[model samples]
Target: MSYYDVDAILTDAQKVPCTFELTVPGLGHLEGNPGAEVKEGTKLELPLWLAQMLAITPAGTKPGMITLDLPDSLSQKVTNALRADPRTVELRSLAPHFFNLGTRMLDLFEEEELSDLLTESFKLRAKELADHAHNPRGALGEGAEFLQGLDENERRLFRATHEGAKAVRAWLVGMQKK
Candidate 1:
Protein backbone atom coordinates (compact mmCIF):
# COMPACT_ATOMS: atom_id res chain seq x y z
CA MET A 1 0.00 0.00 0.00
CA SER A 2 1.01 3.62 -0.50
CA TYR A 3 2.31 5.74 2.41
CA TYR A 4 -0.84 7.86 2.32
CA ASP A 5 -3.00 4.78 2.85
CA VAL A 6 -1.02 3.61 5.87
CA ASP A 7 -0.21 7.05 7.35
CA ALA A 8 -3.54 7.46 9.12
CA ILE A 9 -3.63 3.92 10.41
CA LEU A 10 -0.11 4.13 11.83
CA THR A 11 -0.73 7.62 13.23
CA ASP A 12 -3.73 6.53 15.25
CA ALA A 13 -2.65 2.98 15.90
CA GLN A 14 -3.62 1.83 19.38
CA LYS A 15 -0.83 1.37 21.88
CA VAL A 16 0.01 -2.27 22.12
CA PRO A 17 1.26 -3.86 25.32
CA CYS A 18 5.00 -4.26 25.48
CA THR A 19 6.93 -6.79 27.48
CA PHE A 20 9.27 -4.11 28.85
CA GLU A 21 8.54 -3.06 32.42
CA LEU A 22 9.01 0.54 33.47
CA THR A 23 11.75 1.31 36.02
CA VAL A 24 10.59 4.95 36.06
CA PRO A 25 7.48 6.72 34.77
CA GLY A 26 7.66 8.61 31.48
CA LEU A 27 6.00 12.05 31.43
CA GLY A 28 3.97 11.54 28.25
CA HIS A 29 0.67 9.79 28.85
CA LEU A 30 -0.67 7.31 26.38
CA GLU A 31 -3.95 8.06 24.62
CA GLY A 32 -7.08 7.43 26.71
CA ASN A 33 -4.88 7.38 29.77
CA PRO A 34 -5.54 9.35 32.95
CA GLY A 35 -3.00 10.70 35.43
CA ALA A 36 -2.67 7.29 36.92
CA GLU A 37 0.22 6.52 39.22
CA VAL A 38 3.25 5.47 37.15
CA LYS A 39 5.83 3.97 39.38
CA GLU A 40 8.56 1.43 38.90
CA GLY A 41 7.55 -1.96 37.55
CA THR A 42 4.47 -0.41 35.93
CA LYS A 43 3.43 -2.16 32.73
CA LEU A 44 2.73 0.27 29.91
CA GLU A 45 1.20 0.12 26.46
CA LEU A 46 2.94 2.94 24.62
CA PRO A 47 1.71 4.89 21.63
CA LEU A 48 3.83 4.60 18.52
CA TRP A 49 5.31 8.10 18.85
CA LEU A 50 6.24 7.66 22.52
CA ALA A 51 7.62 4.21 21.92
CA GLN A 52 9.78 5.48 19.04
CA MET A 53 11.10 8.32 21.21
CA LEU A 54 11.86 6.09 24.17
CA ALA A 55 13.54 3.48 22.02
CA ILE A 56 15.90 6.06 20.49
CA THR A 57 17.85 6.84 23.68
CA PRO A 58 19.64 4.82 26.33
CA ALA A 59 17.36 3.22 28.93
CA GLY A 60 18.94 5.11 31.87
CA THR A 61 18.32 8.61 30.46
CA LYS A 62 14.58 8.71 30.97
CA PRO A 63 13.64 9.46 34.57
CA GLY A 64 10.68 7.23 33.84
CA MET A 65 12.95 4.38 32.91
CA ILE A 66 11.68 1.31 31.10
CA THR A 67 12.87 -1.64 29.14
CA LEU A 68 13.41 -0.92 25.46
CA ASP A 69 12.87 -3.70 23.00
CA LEU A 70 15.20 -3.83 20.03
CA PRO A 71 14.14 -4.98 16.60
CA ASP A 72 15.38 -8.26 15.18
CA SER A 73 17.94 -8.38 12.39
CA LEU A 74 16.81 -8.36 8.79
CA SER A 75 16.64 -11.72 7.07
CA GLN A 76 19.84 -13.05 5.53
CA LYS A 77 18.20 -12.98 2.11
CA VAL A 78 17.50 -9.27 2.51
CA THR A 79 21.08 -8.67 3.61
CA ASN A 80 22.32 -10.40 0.47
CA ALA A 81 20.08 -8.24 -1.67
CA LEU A 82 21.50 -5.10 -0.07
CA ARG A 83 24.95 -6.24 -1.11
CA ALA A 84 23.86 -6.74 -4.73
CA ASP A 85 23.76 -4.20 -7.56
CA PRO A 86 21.21 -1.47 -6.88
CA ARG A 87 20.40 -1.14 -10.56
CA THR A 88 19.26 -4.76 -10.78
CA VAL A 89 17.27 -4.49 -7.56
CA GLU A 90 13.66 -3.60 -8.31
CA LEU A 91 12.77 -0.35 -6.55
CA ARG A 92 9.02 -0.53 -7.23
CA SER A 93 8.82 -4.13 -6.06
CA LEU A 94 10.85 -3.91 -2.81
CA ALA A 95 13.41 -1.17 -2.21
CA PRO A 96 10.97 1.66 -1.56
CA HIS A 97 9.34 -0.06 1.41
CA PHE A 98 12.67 -1.08 2.95
CA PHE A 99 14.03 2.43 2.58
CA ASN A 100 10.93 4.04 4.08
CA LEU A 101 10.69 1.63 6.99
CA GLY A 102 14.38 1.84 7.79
CA THR A 103 14.32 5.66 7.64
CA ARG A 104 11.33 6.20 9.93
CA MET A 105 12.33 3.55 12.48
CA LEU A 106 16.09 3.91 12.23
CA ASP A 107 16.45 4.01 16.03
CA LEU A 108 14.53 0.80 16.51
CA PHE A 109 16.59 -1.33 14.13
CA GLU A 110 20.27 -1.96 13.43
CA GLU A 111 20.00 -1.71 9.65
CA GLU A 112 22.49 1.07 9.03
CA GLU A 113 24.47 -0.99 6.52
CA LEU A 114 21.34 -1.96 4.68
CA SER A 115 20.09 1.63 4.70
CA ASP A 116 23.37 2.88 3.33
CA LEU A 117 23.37 0.30 0.58
CA LEU A 118 19.79 1.20 -0.36
CA THR A 119 20.58 4.90 -0.39
CA GLU A 120 23.43 4.33 -2.81
CA SER A 121 21.21 2.14 -4.93
CA PHE A 122 18.58 4.87 -5.06
CA LYS A 123 21.13 7.36 -6.35
CA LEU A 124 22.28 4.96 -9.05
CA ARG A 125 18.74 4.04 -10.07
CA ALA A 126 17.62 7.66 -10.15
CA LYS A 127 20.48 8.55 -12.48
CA GLU A 128 19.47 5.71 -14.77
CA LEU A 129 15.86 6.93 -14.78
CA ALA A 130 16.95 10.47 -15.57
CA ASP A 131 19.21 9.28 -18.36
CA HIS A 132 16.36 7.29 -19.90
CA ALA A 133 14.02 10.26 -19.71
CA HIS A 134 16.58 12.57 -21.29
CA ASN A 135 16.78 10.36 -24.36
CA PRO A 136 13.64 8.48 -25.25
CA ARG A 137 13.54 6.08 -28.23
CA GLY A 138 9.82 5.88 -29.05
CA ALA A 139 6.35 4.96 -27.71
CA LEU A 140 6.66 1.30 -28.69
CA GLY A 141 10.14 1.06 -27.18
CA GLU A 142 11.05 -0.87 -24.03
CA GLY A 143 11.35 2.29 -21.91
CA ALA A 144 7.70 3.32 -22.32
CA GLU A 145 6.39 -0.12 -21.39
CA PHE A 146 8.82 -0.37 -18.46
CA LEU A 147 7.43 2.84 -16.99
CA GLN A 148 3.84 1.63 -17.31
CA GLY A 149 4.29 -0.87 -14.48
CA LEU A 150 5.88 1.40 -11.86
CA ASP A 151 4.32 1.78 -8.40
CA GLU A 152 3.32 5.19 -7.13
CA ASN A 153 6.66 5.92 -5.48
CA GLU A 154 8.63 4.81 -8.49
CA ARG A 155 6.29 6.71 -10.77
CA ARG A 156 6.87 9.87 -8.81
CA LEU A 157 10.61 9.60 -9.41
CA PHE A 158 10.07 8.82 -13.07
CA ARG A 159 7.63 11.69 -13.41
CA ALA A 160 10.21 14.19 -12.22
CA THR A 161 12.75 12.92 -14.72
CA HIS A 162 10.17 12.87 -17.46
CA GLU A 163 9.20 16.46 -16.74
CA GLY A 164 12.80 17.58 -16.94
CA ALA A 165 13.15 15.85 -20.27
CA LYS A 166 9.95 17.43 -21.56
CA ALA A 167 11.18 20.90 -20.66
CA VAL A 168 14.49 20.35 -22.45
CA ARG A 169 12.77 18.83 -25.47
CA ALA A 170 10.38 21.83 -25.67
CA TRP A 171 13.29 24.23 -25.47
CA LEU A 172 14.98 22.42 -28.36
CA VAL A 173 11.80 22.70 -30.42
CA GLY A 174 11.51 26.42 -29.63
CA MET A 175 15.15 26.96 -30.62
CA GLN A 176 14.45 25.28 -33.96
CA LYS A 177 11.42 27.59 -34.45
CA LYS A 178 13.48 30.69 -33.66
Candidate 2:
Protein backbone atom coordinates (compact mmCIF):
# COMPACT_ATOMS: atom_id res chain seq x y z
CA MET A 1 0.00 0.00 0.00
CA SER A 2 2.65 2.44 -0.85
CA TYR A 3 0.83 5.71 -1.50
CA TYR A 4 3.46 6.68 -4.04
CA ASP A 5 4.10 4.15 -6.78
CA VAL A 6 6.35 6.57 -8.64
CA ASP A 7 9.27 4.16 -8.24
CA ALA A 8 7.41 1.31 -9.87
CA ILE A 9 6.17 3.60 -12.61
CA LEU A 10 9.73 4.82 -13.19
CA THR A 11 11.10 1.29 -13.20
CA ASP A 12 8.67 0.19 -15.89
CA ALA A 13 9.14 3.40 -17.86
CA GLN A 14 12.95 3.15 -17.79
CA LYS A 15 12.86 0.04 -19.94
CA VAL A 16 11.35 1.91 -22.85
CA PRO A 17 13.40 4.19 -25.15
CA CYS A 18 11.92 7.52 -26.24
CA THR A 19 12.68 9.37 -29.46
CA PHE A 20 14.17 12.88 -29.23
CA GLU A 21 16.29 15.39 -31.14
CA LEU A 22 18.64 18.21 -30.19
CA THR A 23 17.97 21.69 -31.56
CA VAL A 24 20.66 23.91 -30.01
CA PRO A 25 24.38 23.26 -30.38
CA GLY A 26 26.92 22.72 -27.54
CA LEU A 27 24.88 19.92 -26.00
CA GLY A 28 27.49 17.72 -27.61
CA HIS A 29 27.46 13.97 -28.18
CA LEU A 30 25.44 11.75 -25.84
CA GLU A 31 26.15 8.15 -24.88
CA GLY A 32 24.02 6.85 -27.71
CA ASN A 33 25.94 8.88 -30.30
CA PRO A 34 29.41 7.53 -29.80
CA GLY A 35 32.00 9.52 -31.79
CA ALA A 36 29.14 11.41 -33.34
CA GLU A 37 28.18 15.05 -32.93
CA VAL A 38 24.74 15.91 -31.48
CA LYS A 39 23.47 18.85 -33.45
CA GLU A 40 20.23 20.25 -34.78
CA GLY A 41 18.17 17.77 -36.81
CA THR A 42 20.12 14.89 -35.23
CA LYS A 43 17.67 12.24 -34.14
CA LEU A 44 18.60 9.67 -31.54
CA GLU A 45 17.00 6.99 -29.41
CA LEU A 46 18.15 6.82 -25.85
CA PRO A 47 16.92 6.18 -22.31
CA LEU A 48 14.45 8.50 -20.58
CA TRP A 49 17.15 10.43 -18.70
CA LEU A 50 18.85 11.60 -21.86
CA ALA A 51 15.54 12.39 -23.48
CA GLN A 52 14.36 14.23 -20.37
CA MET A 53 17.58 16.19 -20.22
CA LEU A 54 17.27 17.25 -23.81
CA ALA A 55 13.65 18.13 -23.19
CA ILE A 56 14.48 20.43 -20.25
CA THR A 57 17.66 21.94 -21.65
CA PRO A 58 17.49 25.66 -22.50
CA ALA A 59 17.91 24.87 -26.15
CA GLY A 60 15.45 22.02 -25.89
CA THR A 61 12.63 24.43 -25.01
CA LYS A 62 13.02 26.20 -28.32
CA PRO A 63 10.47 25.21 -30.91
CA GLY A 64 11.75 22.72 -33.47
CA MET A 65 14.95 22.63 -31.43
CA ILE A 66 13.82 19.50 -29.63
CA THR A 67 11.12 17.13 -30.69
CA LEU A 68 9.97 14.25 -28.55
CA ASP A 69 8.20 11.28 -30.02
CA LEU A 70 6.70 9.23 -27.23
CA PRO A 71 5.25 5.97 -28.40
CA ASP A 72 2.09 4.74 -26.76
CA SER A 73 -0.26 3.14 -29.22
CA LEU A 74 -3.00 2.79 -26.66
CA SER A 75 -2.60 6.34 -25.44
CA GLN A 76 -2.92 7.67 -28.95
CA LYS A 77 -6.18 5.81 -29.34
CA VAL A 78 -7.41 6.98 -25.96
CA THR A 79 -6.53 10.53 -26.83
CA ASN A 80 -8.51 10.29 -30.00
CA ALA A 81 -11.43 8.78 -28.16
CA LEU A 82 -11.32 11.47 -25.51
CA ARG A 83 -11.32 14.12 -28.18
CA ALA A 84 -14.35 12.55 -29.78
CA ASP A 85 -16.05 12.22 -26.40
CA PRO A 86 -14.61 11.98 -22.90
CA ARG A 87 -17.11 9.26 -22.06
CA THR A 88 -15.97 7.13 -24.99
CA VAL A 89 -12.70 6.20 -23.31
CA GLU A 90 -12.55 3.88 -20.33
CA LEU A 91 -10.69 5.45 -17.42
CA ARG A 92 -9.45 2.07 -16.21
CA SER A 93 -7.94 1.28 -19.59
CA LEU A 94 -5.73 4.36 -19.65
CA ALA A 95 -2.20 3.52 -18.56
CA PRO A 96 -0.83 5.25 -15.47
CA HIS A 97 2.52 5.11 -17.25
CA PHE A 98 1.21 7.48 -19.86
CA PHE A 99 0.01 9.89 -17.20
CA ASN A 100 3.35 9.88 -15.41
CA LEU A 101 5.47 9.87 -18.56
CA GLY A 102 3.28 12.38 -20.33
CA THR A 103 3.46 14.85 -17.44
CA ARG A 104 7.24 15.04 -17.77
CA MET A 105 6.89 15.64 -21.49
CA LEU A 106 3.82 17.87 -21.24
CA ASP A 107 5.56 20.68 -23.11
CA LEU A 108 5.87 18.45 -26.13
CA PHE A 109 2.43 16.88 -25.78
CA GLU A 110 0.39 19.92 -24.70
CA GLU A 111 -0.74 20.54 -28.24
CA GLU A 112 -2.44 17.15 -28.41
CA GLU A 113 -5.99 16.96 -27.07
CA LEU A 114 -5.06 13.67 -25.47
CA SER A 115 -2.79 15.29 -22.91
CA ASP A 116 -5.60 17.33 -21.38
CA LEU A 117 -8.09 14.52 -21.70
CA LEU A 118 -5.70 12.06 -20.15
CA THR A 119 -4.94 14.48 -17.35
CA GLU A 120 -8.62 14.80 -16.55
CA SER A 121 -9.11 11.05 -16.79
CA PHE A 122 -6.15 10.34 -14.52
CA LYS A 123 -7.32 12.75 -11.86
CA LEU A 124 -10.82 11.32 -11.95
CA ARG A 125 -9.56 7.76 -11.67
CA ALA A 126 -7.31 8.72 -8.78
CA LYS A 127 -10.22 10.20 -6.89
CA GLU A 128 -12.25 7.10 -7.69
CA LEU A 129 -9.47 4.92 -6.33
CA ALA A 130 -9.40 6.89 -3.10
CA ASP A 131 -13.16 6.52 -2.74
CA HIS A 132 -12.92 2.79 -3.22
CA ALA A 133 -10.19 2.64 -0.59
CA HIS A 134 -12.44 4.20 2.01
CA ASN A 135 -14.80 1.28 1.89
CA PRO A 136 -12.42 -1.25 3.39
CA ARG A 137 -15.18 -3.57 4.55
CA GLY A 138 -16.93 -3.66 1.21
CA ALA A 139 -16.74 -6.76 -0.94
CA LEU A 140 -14.60 -6.93 -4.04
CA GLY A 141 -16.96 -4.85 -6.14
CA GLU A 142 -16.67 -3.58 -9.67
CA GLY A 143 -13.67 -1.56 -8.66
CA ALA A 144 -11.79 -4.67 -7.57
CA GLU A 145 -12.70 -6.43 -10.78
CA PHE A 146 -11.62 -3.43 -12.79
CA LEU A 147 -8.35 -3.25 -10.91
CA GLN A 148 -7.63 -6.94 -11.48
CA GLY A 149 -7.82 -6.43 -15.22
CA LEU A 150 -5.59 -3.36 -15.25
CA ASP A 151 -2.07 -3.28 -16.64
CA GLU A 152 1.01 -2.97 -14.43
CA ASN A 153 0.68 0.75 -13.82
CA GLU A 154 -3.04 0.67 -13.19
CA ARG A 155 -2.68 -2.32 -10.90
CA ARG A 156 0.06 -0.58 -9.01
CA LEU A 157 -2.20 2.41 -8.41
CA PHE A 158 -5.00 0.17 -7.18
CA ARG A 159 -2.72 -1.79 -4.88
CA ALA A 160 -1.29 1.36 -3.36
CA THR A 161 -4.70 2.84 -2.70
CA HIS A 162 -6.13 -0.40 -1.34
CA GLU A 163 -3.15 -0.90 0.95
CA GLY A 164 -3.36 2.62 2.26
CA ALA A 165 -7.00 2.11 3.16
CA LYS A 166 -6.26 -1.20 4.88
CA ALA A 167 -3.50 0.40 6.92
CA VAL A 168 -5.74 3.23 8.03
CA ARG A 169 -8.47 0.80 9.03
CA ALA A 170 -5.99 -1.26 10.99
CA TRP A 171 -4.65 1.81 12.73
CA LEU A 172 -8.17 2.92 13.63
CA VAL A 173 -8.94 -0.49 15.07
CA GLY A 174 -5.80 -0.38 17.19
CA MET A 175 -6.71 3.05 18.54
CA GLN A 176 -10.19 1.88 19.45
CA LYS A 177 -8.79 -1.03 21.46
CA LYS A 178 -6.42 1.16 23.45
Q: TM-score winner among the candidates?
A: 1
Could you say which candidate leads in lDDT?
A: 2
Which residue segments of model 1 deviate by more than 4 Å?
1-74, 138-153
Candidate 1 at residue 44, lDDT? Answer: 64
> Using alpha carbons, what is the TM-score of model 1?
0.54
Model 2 stretches astray by more than 4 angstroms: 1-45, 54-66, 73-75, 82-96, 107-109, 112-115, 135-141, 149-178
Task: Compute the lDDT for candidate 1.
Answer: 0.54
Q: In candidate 2, where is summed lDDT lowest over 10 consecutive residues?
A: 11-20
Report the Cα lDDT for residue 162, model 2: 80
All candidates: CA RMSD in angstroms?
7.3, 6.6
Lowest summed lDDT window (length 10), candidate 1 = 64-73
